[model samples]
Target: MVIVPILLLLLLPFVGAQWLVCGDSGNYTSNSTYQANLMLLSSTLPNKAVSNTSVFATATVGHAPDIIYALTLCHGDITDASDCESCVAAAFKDAQLSCPYNKEVSTYYDYFMLRFSNHNFLLANSTEDQMKWINLRNTLNFTTGGDSITHLLFMLLNSTAQAAANSSRRFTTSRLGVNIVPTVYCFMQCTPDLTPHDCAACLQVVLKHTLKFLDGAQGGRILGTRCSMRYELYHFYEGVPMLAIPVVNGTTPAPTPATRHNSRKRVLWIIAGVAPLLSILLCVICSVVWTRRRRQGKVNLNDQAATNRPEENELVWRLEEKSSEFTLFDFSEILHATHNFSKENLLGQGGFGPVYKGQLPDGMQIAVKRLASHSGQGFTEFKNEVELIAKLQHNNLVKLLGCCIQGEEKLLVYEYLPNKSLDFFIFERNRTAFIDWNKRRVIIEGIAQGLLYLHKHSWLRIIHRDLKASNILLDQDMNPKISDFGLAKIFSSNDTQGSTKRVVGTYGYMSPEYASEGIYSIKSDVFSFGVLLLEILSGKRNSGFYQYGDFLNLLGYSWQLWEGGTWIELLDASIAKEICTSDARRYINIALMCVQESADDRPTMSDVVAMLNSESGILPEPNHPGYFNLRVSKTHEFFVPCSNNDVTITEEPHGR
Candidate 1:
């Protein structure tokens, strides 16, 4: 979520008005079959919901002429079993008082919701369901006239919705802290029965409905049969928020000349008023000036960017203070080193720009990433890469030496890896012999450790949104180091997941939830790593087709071979004879486990490492991988079978 600094409206409306109910109030006669079914549903729901481990239950109380369908859902964050039971119990009681004898009704509480209908609503989309809403009286008015604040708020809400859509519990809350407005706390949820994509679509409709009543309000909530969303000034749910938007405090407004003159006038008036008590006035003025200067001296200049709203140059200055090792390279020096941006010096290309191999005057080799000026999101990318990579240090991760910010040219310098990237060796025929079984195993473990550092051991929780073979650089010793901070996302220590609509990543490598719904977490990265792991083990790329099998993509082909017990055929002919059968099979199994369609089913990096180290542990069976159905490209003019490699780079929204 992008935070735009704006004035916050603090006034709140009546608290009791923060609830809504929407449904038909159909009349039903007392002692009728409909009434009996309704009564049975109400009586059975509370105890059934309480007893279920998930604290959620659905039931049908009759058949044919009269039947009632009901479900109770506890908020994903609600942990106390008793609290969930009480909330559902109260919802039942409230429904009776609120809409007696109504056949279809929905009721919402802070931590739980109880809904029932005469129709089967488990798979129903939100559009068919009318929304109930409550909005705050306080308007979120920004002094400036622009859509930045509104865009930021919606981005946060959409991200929260996406998270909920992909989550196992179908619920999530988020915080969007922008410079322009007070922190907006958002929560979104959907019925767990819906698929990830369907849930996302449902929440999208709910979001659109919310804007109708919530526009400019400090906060609001919308409830529906399939979904619910809320944005408030304060946290309204239990547990930690899943997505915490990175705060970007906008530039502070500079005082105008007229304001300075007014301040002088006020000072003159004060002096005139205190002239009769000159001694006391002089003492008061002295004390005020001394205290103000002392406070200013103690201010943290290291993070001046947050308060002062500095430009790129000021950002460089402040960053220099934070880390002396990350030098600010001179433009002339970079020009001299790279031979004035010669084409021969270019190494590879990325989404933002080109990377060139440069040799400095001191004989130090470096890789310089020259960001493209026309790539509208370049500034943010530059800031993110510089700030994030400079703080992270590990043998399996690329090292940021420094950066150059000269006018239109923004360059990031890193220690150049002589072996190019993993793609150069993995996808080429002649280079196949270079990475033997031992080397591939080492490279796989190294990459896993790098991910572990980012997810668990780093100073900040990091998610490498784009993790693929091309982004993994290789050193002289055949060791792998993960690169590309441009697409990386930083999560608050407490946050576990995030989402976005502008999905930026290499296509075939993306997990199902992330590729289809834009929801990402550490598990998303784990999914990408799984693809990479399989690529390393089998000497096959996941994105392209193979000529030997009917399977369209590498994942499907690998699964086909694995299940058929012809797994040995999946291995590269070069390394097959020398590799251990059990070890190779075990690694393949681990890769499959990592690429499970559901994020919750995937193991963490720590678990991956432990599983790899264990000699003989029973591994769980992996479900079908995401995108397994996409065997071949549909838009081919001529079917060449295996010549084309489809690696797409998208301008996706920033992850939470």
Candidate 2:
């Protein structure tokens, strides 16, 4: 059975009182600089919000270490500027009293919402702070045509959300009427600053949560930091709805006596027609089931001897128990899908093995990663990826469908992405123009959100030791998904870093400490992300970039331009005209910060995401990047090249 995570308060009636959330970003003393900044924001933010046509305002006060970010948003239905200002000012005072000395506070009132924090949550891409309140007083369900009512409710909500996202004000109200139930008055809104895609995504998330608790309730609402929605039986807002859908085909009227008699005869004829067909269908299903089970039994008996090994037995058992959707494919089935692993079907080859594009009998396309017997990665790495990726569920991470383990053959299956990887478009001159500045920005944000999930949000703390352009796959919509987890490492909640004698990863992406001393941490992954970010921005491969004067790699060349205050020259020619100069500079600053020589100087993935989304705050200056001083030469340098292939390097290296 599935369990819905419903809070206990969901069962109680919503009193429309002020709701508050005290954040865990630590507290400040009354007379501290942080408190003073908070006070200044509280005093000015009300006027700022009232002056705006959208009645929404965001402000950042003070400098680093004591900066305060605050935002106030008045409900879309509230038309009076005085009321909006008054609600916001009262929220600031009430929030301080509710959570004394707190550095982060979120206050929700009936007409307005106020939030202040040391962290910039105004544009953060997360729904962790969503709130929901249900109207338990209305315990009525649409007993008449219940299925149709539920379907109508969802349809209304979905359309309303889309309307809100597309509107200039980012707010919309709608009502739908049906013969079998009362009209549902819907309210949907997002902060005007949000992009249409982000607003829709945020609304969808809250809608799922709200529906789980709603269960066809008469009234309910989900309030989130970025977006919100509400539906009630009675009209709750002041003005008329933007959309009003009339009832259509909701329910059929009762039949007359003569029609009832005819209906009975029709039903009898329909039963007679379907009975024979149903019996034959049942027989066919039983025959198919019997044959399949017999074949599976024979295969199981044949494989029993090979599965006797303890390690293999444990691995198979754990995988089967981990997820019911995890399938154990037969070698014959895979062969049929890939047409005997034909050369034409091959997609790419990696350190682990070759990948092929295949279609199953049911017409589902998949990417099959067939592990080569002599590949550097073996059973341990395969097992790690299968177990780890199966548990991670995120939009930006590739989905693992299943695996196959037969004698001398092992394969992993994933959802097929037609656009291939980031490297395919960014590095190719002809394809560089395909991804404009907006698309590139989306890819960057998607990758950052994926890394943030792996590092802090997922059930298991993970570090993708091999993050690069090739490992980032693009879907049909041009969204990025992080793939290739064979080199990932898991850490406990308390563990911050790890070291090993066996250092492994691509050369240009590895952090200095991880490459020279075999010490790896979350920062190691950040370093790789930094290198990938630069490559995306410049449309040049970092491993072989040697055109600049005395510069060995892209990092050194980028530093030269950055130091000279000519960083705009580092951007790809295609996007240089499309992107704002300020945004390009901000992105370069963030990438440089990620590749800092000292791990302590680099920001965490959380901080990186904030910086990427934040448009107002002053970013910290970056130190010199790692490998920034290296020069190209024929002779061996401090670190010698051990392999011709730049895909991966598994050998141990000496300190520089």
Candidate 3:
């Protein structure tokens, strides 16, 4: 029986009280049959054979522990028994942690969701486009394209399956050229380590779902904890990439900015410089005119603020040292780059109003964030961020390129890192493949070191109250730079912890003590770190995890595996290829230890840094993590087709 995760927010709230309940603790919430089925599937799949594509294994867990376990092999890619166990275990952990308490939760964890249903759930044979069409047609006014479309989709699915089945990574993407020259973009991927045919078969299942229900609309994806397939008539991809499509006759656009600028300069120089220099008489006439302009010198500062170059000394705030290597750009230069804050140039809206990318006159790049006056929640954080970053300097910490505050505008500038953030890579399939073992390990270590500096090594003992993936910026080399210091706190060296009536932080990343009781400290950062480590290793998010296997977060699942001596099973497939098995096991052990249920049991950031940097000795075994014992409810979701966010998903709350 397939387990489907459920979403139910049927909470019994007291006027002013919070209650913790679980089977071991003596209080348990009894759920309905439907709830049970949802929870069962929400629990991770115990085992699914990639060879058994016949059994549908789509699972989503709610806040309750109700996911049922099952095994179904994909058509042809079955491998050793070890691969099956690991995939299921990883999937279960993912669903539980990432889709924490929500009722409806679904993610492509490992390959499948071992789930159960309240009613007889029919498995349908469909393609992604067909299902999209069905959903759109039933929901909107649209025409049906008939069996011809379905047949075409089926053929595309088979091709992707065939390719995936042949590759060890078990993933394939292709554009099928149909009769009208319509390109059907299809993508298929199974657990990375899965053998070829299993990948193909697992993808085939998703393809079937796409054709069966969606009915070929604009776009939709059929995703599972294991393998998945996605197709769209529309191009939904956006990122920095070199397209794989080979062109038979078109000239490739120059990939670098320097090339384009050089080409432009070549044309401009001919019009002004070369043309003027060619004639002496014309040059003398121009010089005389220029002399006349020089005679009009000593113009009073009509607008003292309106310097073409914004003065650097005007906005410097309490600087201990200065680094001239980096350019200190003025606000006006930035305004021009973004066309005076044009809505069209805006990249994304953030807590601090909006962030814009800019190009300086000299071709230097920067990211400008204009703090919004209406952002009440962000005001304090924004001021705090500007103050904190100005005082500290480190490679892993985001470099504060400059700041601007003239009149009403409060703009903070940063060295624009081309790769953006960690979230860009971890939640997508196509992108995760590029973050090799070396790169991920570097990111993990850099974050740890950066956090260590904040907590202990910095001039002031600090706590990054808000730590998440989106805050972790990735440089061009894929190096991670921890950012967003607005929520940071300066704690006295002797203080072990603190409490607040108003607690702030992302839900999944927040430690139980902080989230539920307002208690926080260095240990809280440790808890977040543990989650980050798990996410880096697994490429799954901790928040919105839907698998049902009796864990409230990824920490709990990692602890169970470490306790069971199978923690290496949690590694992301892409990371697994290069992982030294022993090191992988050690890393998980350290991560679990960092997330121990009790604050006292968790290691300091310093200790974590030592453990990561030094492979000297065998680390101590980790006990069960705190805050992982909550019993979650579950819900069921019908057959959905497959899709991938080019980057792999991390199991940590950083992405939340």
lDDT of each: 0.71, 0.77, 0.57
In model 3, which regions exceed 4 Å deviation? Answer: 1-331, 342-351, 377-379, 406-408, 548-552, 634-656
Q: After superposition, how far is residue 94 of candidate 1 from its true place, in Å?
A: 95
Candidate 2 or 1, higher lDDT: 2
Q: List runs of model 1 lying over 4 Å from the truth.
A: 1-321, 545-548, 632-656
User: Could you say which candidate leads in lDDT?
Assistant: 2
Taking the tens digit of each residue's C-alpha lDDT, what string does model 2 give over 73-138?
888887688998987888888889879999998777766778888876554543333332332324
Judged by lDDT relative to the true structure, which candidate is superior, 2 or 3?
Answer: 2
Give the runs in model 2 whose Cα sits over 4 Å from its true position: 1-315, 318-324, 633-656
lDDT of 2: 0.77
Q: Residues 513-544, candidate 1, lDDT per residue (tens digit)?
A: 77666678999999999999888877777764
Report the poorest 10 consecutive residues by lDDT, candidate 3: 128-137
Prediction RMSDs, each to the true structure: 27.0, 26.6, 31.6
Worst lDDT run of 10 residues, candidate 2, spans 1-10
Clashing pairs in 2: none
